[model samples]
Every structure is written in structure tokens, then in C-alpha cells.
Target chain A: MDIDTLDLIDQYLRGNLSDTEKEAFEKRIAIEEDLQEEVLIHQQLLAIHEQEKISLTNTSYQQELVQMNEILNEEDNAKLSQKIRAIGKNQQPHTTVRFKRKKTVNWFYSAAASIVVLISLFFIFNTPKALPDYYQNYVNWEELPSFTVKGDPEELFEKGEVFFKNKEYKNAVATLSIIEPEDKWYPFALLYLGASYDQLNENEAAIATFQKLASLTTSEEYSKGYWYQLLLYLKTNQKEKALEMKTKILENPNHYKYKEATELDF
Target chain B: MENTERYIQALIQGEDQIIQEIYKKIYPKVLAFILYNKGNEDDALDVFHDALMYIIITQKEKRSVILSFEAYLFVICKNIWKKNLKNKVIQTDVLTLEEKETNLSAFILEQQCFEFYIAKFSLLSENCKDILSSYFNGLSYEEITLANAYATVNTVRQRVFKCRSKLIELIKNDKEFQKIIKWGA
Candidate 1:
């Protein structure tokens, strides 16, 4: 095939051709089997290229998760270290003074008994439901109704919604953050932005976003900010703050998540 | 229904919480299966990760319309472990007869196609790879030119066309590609 024909196919696939040219190309594709096959081949190649991009994006995300996991593991190690130090402090004087052979036997039995109690307590308290369980139970963001807007903002909003719906929380946060303040969907975008941050475990950013939304807008227009903030606190085990938000929600039964909030307990 | 879709979407998007949930919910069963089939904990984790990657790539390729994400994942993990253990004398009673003959072949074919494409992509020049990567990522000609200082808008367009043509030619001429297509038929 000529380079011009290849160029036309490229332009057509990219939706870059003018209306008349696109019509002519479509007419030619109908009659020319080879051209049709070439178009199909071009489309297949494009899909392969797209797959490569997605793979690359996924690799980056995997790296980010690895780093995040390392950070979490370090935090866990630090906490474990602190707990060990506390245990050592509790036993330091006792170990120093109880060096007698007769006391050593009693100390061994007491230590064994203490270990048994610690193990029992660990099993008992470790059964507390996890944060993810609470998230899955309470955080249900329904699919928003589809509507049309006229300009570039419409495209931006749609892209954000696509990321949000696909559960691409990081991508959703990035995309939704670009919505202009004057856009009709700005407030809604902020809400979803907070939701995205919450999903990403960026609780501080999520709380800041919700706080901004709550302070900037009236309760009737942005009650979801409070609702989501309440759930965010609950998911992170901040029951006191969550209860405060819950009381606020209950004070006004007209809030959107009032029923769900009422059903929740510390 | 929504949960299954959410799981698939989460894997594709690489969401942290949902991924952790998947590990919590599904990894234990996969680990148990692998242990029962003469594999260790590390091997089980590796197999599970590979299976998850394969499922994500297959989904991206639009190869399978998943019915049940959990069941599909478990099946894939089991098949992978069995394939690893095929050289050993082991009871193969874990898989249902229907699953044995049907999806396994298709899955293998898809894997072959994916590997072939990756190999072919690796053969392209660095410049072509850069331009084509940007193009496939939905960058406009003007944006591509702006991002890559050496290229003009027109040059970017021409380069993209040439690079894609070369890629298609390479893929078409690949011996494994022919075999894969024939087998997929």
C-alpha cells in the first residue's frame, strides 16, 4: 500500500480526518477487501500498542505498591520494637533482683504463665474486624446518572468518572483534581476525589478534601462530604470523631447517608 | 455480580485496598492448593502472582468475558500449579474434566500470543518505541512533538506511521505468530 493510503488509514483511525475524507475512506473500505484487511491489521496493532501502555502503567503501579508495602512494614517493625522495649522495661528490675536460684524457678513459671496470657489475649483481641471489612460494609458509591456537557470540561469529567468507575483510585484522583472551579461538576468531582484518596489509603488527604468541601458548601448541597468523612474516620478506627460526625448527621435526618449512619455502632 | 466486576476492575487498575483484600480472600486457597500439590509457600505466592498477571493481561486483551472472577482465578491458579507439576507423578483429580480440555488450550494460546508480541516490541529501535508509546497512550501529534523536543508535529505523524507499519510487518513475519494464529483457529 502507498504511504498516502497508510496515512489516510492512520488519520481515519485517529478520528483526525475531515467529514468528506472520512466518508470517502469509508466508501473505499466497503469496496476494497485489502484495504479493509489493512484497517483491521492497523486496529489490531493499535490494540497491541495500547496493551503495552497498560502493562507499563501496571508496572509503575506495582512499584508504588511495593514501596507502600515497605513503608507499612517499617511502621509495623517500629511498633513491634516499641512493644518489645515496653516489655523489657517491665522485666528489667525484676530480672536484676530475682537472680537467686530459688527465685529463678518461680520467675520461669511466672514468665511462662505471662506468655500464655499474652497469647490468649492476642488471639482474643486480634479478632477485631479489619478496616477493609468496615470499608466494604459501609462505603458504597453508586454509579452516577449519565449526562452530557458541551465542552472540554465534559470530556475531563467523563475521563474522571471512567477512572472512578474502573476503581483506578490514583488515576481518578489525578483526573478529577483538574476540574476547573467554575465547572458545574466541580463539587461532585471534589467528592469523588476524596473518595479516591480514601480508597488509596491517603486518609489525611481525603479528610482535608472532605473538610474543604464541608466548609465551602452548604449542608444541603454537600452533605456527602460529611457522610464520607464520617465513614473515613470509622474505617481508620477513629471512633470518637466518627461519632461526632454521626451525631451531626443524626441531627439532620435529611442528610443522604443519615440512615446508614444511624445503623452504625462503635 | 457487582463484587465480581469490582474485583476484576480492581486487578486491572491495581487498587491497593482491593488488591490487599484479594490477597486476604483468595491467596490462602491458592496457597493451600499449591501446598497440597507439592509446592512451598514462596512457590505458591509466585504462581498466584503470575496467574493474576496473566488474568489481567488476558482481560486487557478482551479475550475472556469473565463469569465469576473468583472461580476463574482459582481455576487459573490450579491449572498453573498442575502444569508445574506435570513432570512429577501426581494425582490430577483436582480439575474438572470439562475445564481440562476447553479453556486451558485457549489460555495457553493467549499466553503465546502475548509473549510473541512482547518479543516483537522489544526489537524496535529506541526512538520508534518512544514515539509509538506516546502515540498509543493517546497523545496527540502536537503533544507528542512538544514532549519530544527533536520532533516536529509533521515528523511525529510520519514517524508514528512508519513505526506502526514496521511493527505490523514484524508481527506478521514472526514464525510464532503464524503458529499462534493457526493454533487459535
Candidate 2:
């Protein structure tokens, strides 16, 4: 209880006390129940302190994860770039980023579908679906689709349209591709998918997809058809084409979606 | 076995595969921990995520990890709950469980006792608290002295010793804490 005894106890903890002092403190703790009790408390606290470091997902950790995700994304992009260059092919990164974005949108749909599936499983059987909850929750990322775009091409287009209405585009794209010209929904799918590609920062794919959609026959073109393409061009800073699309929109002021298109700058 | 193999490796590598593994293998445990801690489904989820993130960070940082990943995860979650308590955050759960004669029960009790001791730490004078905290934070005597503006390293040393003794006194006299140990033991 005395300051000297307390100081000696502290030094003992620090292992900084001279040998004589340590011996004295040890003796006191042995003979004195009160001193022994104090030692136990200190030791307990020490143990707790040693094992009790803070966790991330604490705000500090979240900040770090954002930084980490950015780094990982950059690494993935680099890997993708290297592989693309190695392919004895002609492709642009704009296209790659577009492809990545489409993948991202597909994942978004997969997540939505997984939720629907989970809800159905819960309701139907009051149990988890075949997918385990943990992995099921992580189905935030979808893989390439399993459904083929086969059947009567026109019927497939009809099915694709239904899917588009349901917002299942990966399946819709597969379905629609078999139909005439693929143009019935090609413009819409192309533009949306191109945007998806853009969202993933795969610029080249987005531009090419958008351009191909834009070049369809005038009969298929919306009065404001170019707006969608223009948006893609604008996104990639393809000023010439974006401007051209804008001019096309300007010339056909009466086209459907044109008023809305004019109100916006691509 | 293939599923387990795929998931655990993915988890070990910090991939999303562990999310499935966790849902299947460990989510029940996490949910149980949450439910015991007076938490709901949401807390169970948040704690589970935080624990996994902590494990990945620790592993990535090359910390020596020898415990079963399951045990390590629960401990991290428990620690996070304690910090939540200290920060006066919304804490609806205390993870109370019936005393039982099992190693897991003992470990839980041990954690409860440690938490009790840690709570008692706040009762000390701020200076005493600071000195003790500095020591535990791995501050050197010189760093402690410089930070606290003590006259010398000897002064810092003397202060830390006194702080430890005071902490002991606080811990011994806390009856509630003793009861936790008794029930836990």
C-alpha cells in the first residue's frame, strides 16, 4: 500500500527493478495475500491486453479495404491487358473495360436472382436452398451463363425480349443473338451492354458494341438512335463520333426520345 | 470434402469462396455467438464479416497464426464486441451463457473475466491509465517519458510500476468481476 511498495511492484512488472528489489517484491507478494491478489489482477489485465487487439471493418479497416479493392482492381486490369496483348488479335482496352462492365452488370443480376432464389427456397421449404447461405450470399458475382441462345431465331428474340423485360440480359443477349439481324433488340442490348462494358472501364468493347449498333440500317434506327451511341462515344471521349451522333440527333429533332436526348449532352 | 477443400482454400486466400464455406461451416457458430451476445441476425452478419476481414488482414500482414481458424474468428469477434462496449456504441448483447464444465465454456468464462478486468481499468486515474496503456502499446521507457513529458526514463519507469500496482488493487476489490470468474470457473 505504501508508495515505495507500489513503485517496487511496478518495477517488478517492468522487470526493471534491481535483483534485490525483485526479491523483496517477490517475498512481499508471497507472504502478503493482498500483494498476491494485486499480482493476479495485473497478470489478468496483461493477458487480456495481449490478446485483445482491435479488428478491421472497424471504420479504419473499411478505409483500408477500399484502398485494397482499388489496388486489386488495378492488378486485375493489368493482368487482363497483358493477356489481351498476347492474343494474336486486334482488340482495344476500351472494349475490354466494356466487357468487364458487362460482367459486373451480369453479377448484379446474379445477385438479384440469388436473392429471389433464396426467398423462394425459404418460402417453399422454410429452409436454405441447395446453395449454402454463406456462398449464396457471395453469389454477388455471377459466372458465364449456362442457357444457350438456341431455338427458332424469332422465338428466341421473343424470349429475349421477355428476359429483357425481366432484366435478365445475359440470358436475353444469348436468346436474341439468334434472331434476324439481331437488330430488333440489338440496338437496345448493344447500347446497354456497351454501357455495362463502360461501367467496368472496358472502353473499347463499349465503343465497338455501340458503333455496331449505331451502323444498323436507317429503317432500324430510332430518330434519336444516335443518342445512345453518342453517350458511348462521349464516355470514351470519342469526340468526333459523339458530335456526329449529336448532330444526327439535332437533324432529326422529331425522332422518338429526341426531346429527352436534346435536353442532355452526351 | 471437395466442397470443403475448395472453400477453405478460398477463405485462406481471402476469396469469396469462403463466404460459402462460412455460411455452411461457421455461420451457425457466428450466429450463435451473436444470439448469445444478445444480438440479432444483423449483428451476426456484421460480426461475421468483421471477423473474416480481421483474419484476412492479420494473415496478409504475416502475423503468426496457429489457432484453428474457427477459434481465431470467434476470438476476433469477441474482441470487436468488447471495443464496441468501450466506445459506448449501441450494445444490445453481452453474450451471456449458462456455466458449463467444458473447455469451450472455460474459454468463454476466461474471456468474460478478462472483459471484466478490462472494464475495471477505466476506474483508474487518467494518468495511471495512460502510463499503463503506453506500456502495453509497446512504447519504450524513453517514448513513454517523451510522450508524457516525464523528467526522465526513470520517472516514466517509476510511473508505469505504480500504475500496474494500482491496476491490481482495482481488480482485486471488484466483487462483480470475481463473481464472473466464479460462475465461469
The best candidate by lDDT is 1
- In the order shown, the candidates' DockQ scores are 0.05, 0.06
Give the least accurate 10-residue stretch of model 1 chain A, judged by summed lDDT. Answer: A94-103
Task: Please give the clash total of every predicted structure, in order.
Answer: 0, 18
Per-residue alpha-carbon lDDT of candidate 1 for residues B1-185, written as tens digits (9 for 90 to 100):
56778987776666656766666556645654554455655556555665665565456555445677778788778766765565235654544433432223333444445556666777899999998888866788899989998557888878888887788788778665554433322
| CA lDDT of each prediction against the hidden true structure | 0.61, 0.49
Give the distance in Å from residue B64's predicted Cα in candidate 1 to where it truly belongs. Answer: 24
Q: Give the clashing residue pairs of candidate 1, or none.
A: none
* Per-model TM against the reference: 0.32, 0.33
Model 2: docking quality category: incorrect
Error of 2 at A180 (Å): 48
In candidate 2, residue A113 scores what lDDT?
41
Estimate, for each residue in B59-156, the C-alpha lDDT of model 2 and write its tens digit: 44344424366665667677655554443355344443211112122233344455557667877899888888878766888999888789999888
